[model samples]
Target: MGALDVSKIVQGRQGWRLITCIWLHAGVVHLLINVLCLLFIGIRLEQEFGFVRIGLVYLISGFGGSLMSALFIRSSISVGASGALFGLIGSMLSELITNWSLYANKVAALLTLVFVIVVNLALGILPRVDNFAHIGGLISGFLLGFVVFIRPQFAWINQKRVAPGQETAPVKRKHKTYQYILWLAAVVLLIVGFTVAIVLLFRGYNANDHCSWCHYLSCVPTKKWKCNSSPQTCTVMQQPNTLDLTCDGTGTHHSYSIAGATQDQISQLCNSLCS
Candidate 1:
């Protein structure tokens, strides 16, 4: 039931929408895409690390995505699991980095992952897509990977394989020192990032005001398609049998017969004219 509505979040203080929105989608196609992506990327993660950690990454990354979209695009509604899906992708990237020593052909794997991430992010720049959410989710999941996906070193694995009571030296720490450092740094960064973003969102801070070019990340104009991100505003004059609409932004005027027309119908007509 929850969709990311900026007014509801800021005015009504419905912060839970940030988490709940991830469960909703704009349409069937949106839902199907996310499901297939989750199947492709998430099942393997669950098998490798189990569901609990991956689920945490999904939910928290979704919240981070919602917070970011709210800050940048405050005029529209957003609903989808793409952000959570992007989180899984980000987690895969970080998982590879954290477990670098475990895999052969590391360079090829790294290059392939980078290519996939870049292509997906490039798609987000199209109109009506929420790239802010994608970026935010990617960052959150990337940091979470360091914290939750830390693997035991090969030395630790070898030590564990030794027979009981035949140990020559003491058992080494399970994780490397660098892993602990990365884990701590990631934890601090996630905490700080979430806190700051949440505070700014509740305060109704529009990120566009600070970064003039940030909107281009979500949409770019092209010859084939027009990218209009601004909201439409219109004034209406209604009579018993007719209605007149005037777009405030563009000063375009149109009229339509409203005989026996419902208010919802008139509103929809006005929106279409304005858009």
Candidate 2:
């Protein structure tokens, strides 16, 4: 099956992929890592806020990450719920800050969450990792945390204090107006970012069909043919030579030599073509 990719998202307008990509993964390892993180973070969040808000955090944060990834990452068919997971982590941090008065051990909670975020973000700097999505989801989730992760008032009140019809005053909603403005600002930025990316994509800006300079993933620097060049033709170190293909009235001819062609490429290509 075709992967959820930027080409389809932008050029084909498959807007659903922003969320759908979270459900895809490169391999079993990718899937398992995401599942573990989701389980750890999701379970806690679900118990606190229920499924609805947690689900919103996952999806909205995933979309935020994917949108940003699409804007700058044109060559990869990125898949994984890392963005969504990171969003949960981000929202957890913001939630702690917004509800600082509620937590029994605010310092410990903040430190643990901060340590998790730092380690994950540090790992993202490795090759083949996507840090952009992490940052995007993080920002989006942090802003959204203010709006979605409202502390339950009843949970904060003393259970034994109630004797009769007397009502317990709910915890003061400490969410400042500036915090809400920040949330709105995040939403506006996301909308504008997506709109501009779509416009640029339609205006003829596209990753080269082969993504020649993108990375080893985009063009597997092997003895293969690509647009206007062969893998061997790339001015890279220790690149082997290519096989010669000639067809005339006489017959098809294939030539190989140690100088230009390696034994493996010659054997493989010859078997595929001549055999």
Stretches off by above 4 angstroms in model 1 are: 165-171, 229-275
- Write the residue-wise lDDT of candidate 1 on 79-173 in tens digits: 99888888888888888888888889899999998999899999998878999899989999999999899899787788878887776565568
Error of 2 at 75 (Å): 1.4
Q: Show model 2 residue runs off by greater than 4 Å.
A: 152-161, 165-275
Q: Cα RMSD to native, each candidate? A: 9.3, 11.2
Model 2 over residues 1-275: C-alpha lDDT tens digits? 33547778767877788888888889999899899989988999999899999999899888778766665465556788888888999999988876666779999999998998888876665556767678778877876786687553334456445668878765564455555665567567656765775576546353332242332222232344321131221111223453563221111244444356555755565333321
Backbone clashes for every candidate come to: 0, 0
TM-score of every model? Answer: 0.82, 0.64
Measured by TM-score, the strongest candidate is 1
